[model samples]
Target chain A: MTDETMLEEDGHSGGVVKKFLYVNRRAPYGSIYALESLEVVLIGAAFEQDVSLLFLDDGVFQLKKGQDTAMTDMKNFSPTYRALEMYDVEKLYADRESIEQRGLTEDDLIVPVEVLSRDEIKDLMAQQDVVLSF
Target chain B: MKFSVLVNEGPYQHEASDSAYHFTKAALEKGHEIFRVFFYHDGVNNGTRLATPPQDDRNITQRWSALAEQHNLDLVVCVAAAQRRGIIDADEMKRHGKDANNIAPGFRISGLGQLIEAGIQADRLITFGD
Candidate 1:
C-alpha cells in the first residue's frame, strides 16, 4: 500500500464522535427554513453523528399525518423524515405541551417518537454538544 | 468563547427575532465573542432600511443597525433571499439594473458559505427561527 493510504488507515486509530441536536419549531410547508433544517439534520446523521430531533410548539405539525403538498407543487419531504431512523437518528421527541395544545395524538404522527415533558425537554437541550434550533 | 447566530425570522413578525437579539446581547454581556449573525429567508427583511413601524413600537432595523455599529458585528443578509424581498444593496441594485437599494447600513449581502464558516469557526451555533 502507498504511504498515504497507510496513513489514512492509521489516522482513524480511534473513533471520533460528533453530537448534534436539531430543534424544529414551525409547521411544515409554511416556510422553507423548516424543511431546510430537516435536510441539514439528516446530513449530520449521515456523518455518523449522534443526532436528536426535538419537535416543539408548531413544529409538531411537521410530524402530522396526511400532509398534501400536491397543490403547492412542493416536494413532500415528510415521508423522507421517517427515513431518519435508518440513519441511526432514532431519538426523535415531541413536546407533550405542544402535542396537547395542537390536539395531536400519538397516532397522528408518522414516526415513533418519545413524548417529553417541558422539564425533560430542557434537560435534553442541555445534553446536546451542538444545538441548532429553527 | 466564539459564537455564531442564525436569525431566520423577521422581527415584529415573530418573537424568535427578539429572542435572538436578547440571546446575542446576553452572550456578549457574558464575554462571548459573536463571530457573525446571518439573516436568511424572511430574516433578510430585518436588514431593510426602509422599514418604518409605528413610533410606539421598537424599530428593529434601527436596533440592528445600532447593535452592529456598537459591536462591529458581522451582520449578513443572504443575497438571493434579499433580492426576492426587495432588499438590494447598492452593488446588487446596479448589477440587477434596479432603481433603488433598500438594504440598511452595517449589513452586507453574503452567501451560505458565510453561514457555514461562521458555524465552523464558532464554539457554538445558535439558530432563532420560526
Candidate 2:
C-alpha cells in the first residue's frame, strides 16, 4: 500500500494504531468463550492494531501444554497459541499469582508468556486503549 | 466522548444486553456519540424480532430498536455469530435459503471487522458481558 492509497482510504476511515488488550479469564473448554476469543484475535489482527493477550484465573489453562483431547469431543487448540506469533500477536501475559495458585509454572505453558503481578496487571490494563474480557 | 459498546450475551438470559442498552441510552442522554453497538456470541439473540416476552415485562429487543431509531444509532450484529445463532436478516435469509428473516429493524448483520473498526473510530470501546 502506497501513501496515495492510504490517503484515499483515510478520507473516510481515519484510524490510528491503538493498544487493544484482550483479557481472557476462562478455561479453554466447557464454554465457547476461549475459542471465540481466539477467533476475534485472528480477525482483529487484520486491522494491524497493537494487540496483547492477558491470561488470568482459569484463562491460564488455555496455554497449558500436553492437552490431550483425543477422548473428548473438544479439539486440542493449544497448538493455535503457538501460531499467534505468526499474526504478530507476540505480547502474551499471565498473572503470576494465578499461575502459582493453580500450581503451574511458566514451563507448564505451551508458549512463552510474561508473568506479572496483580498491581502490574492493573497498570497494564490502564495502559490499554481497549480491554476486551472473555 | 465517542463510544463503542460490545454486547456478548443474550437479551433476557443475561444482563449484558440490558446493561449495554441502558449504558448506550445514558451516553446518548448526556450528549455523547455512540459510534456503534457490536453484538457477538449470544448477543445476536438481542436482534431477533420473534421474541415475545410477557406484556408486563420490558421488551428488550424493542427497546434497542426504538433507541436506534431515535438516535440513528448503528446497531451491528456479528454476521458469523448471528448465522450460528439463527438470527438472519433478509440478505442472509436469502443467501442461506432460510424460510424467513427474524432480524429486527434498526439492526443490521455485518462482519466482525465492524467491531474492530468501531474500536478504532470510537474514543472508547466498552464491553458489557460476562
Per-residue lDDT over B24-54 for candidate 2, one digit per residue giving the tens place of the 0 to 100 score:
9999999999999999889999999999999
What stretches of model 1 exceed 4 Å from their correct place? A1-18, A29-33, A39-50, A70-77, A80-91, A95-123, B12-31, B52-59, B66-70, B79-84, B89-101, B111-120, B123-130
- Model 2 alpha-carbon miss at residue B24, Å: 1.0
Index of the highest-TM-score prediction: 2
- Model 1 chain B worst lDDT window (10 residues): B111-120
The C-alpha TM-scores of every prediction are: 0.62, 0.91
Cα error of candidate 1 at position A130, Å: 3.3
In terms of docking quality, how is candidate 1 classified? incorrect
- Model 2: residues with Cα > 4 Å off, grouped in runs: A1-15
How large is the interface RMSD of candidate 1?
11.3
Pairs that clash in candidate 2? none
DockQ of 1: 0.11
Clashing pairs in 1: none
Q: Please write out the lDDT profile of model 1 over residues A1-134, one tens digit for every residue.
A: 12112212121212444456788888887677677676456444434556789999899999998999899998788887788878788899999999999888989999999999999998998887677777
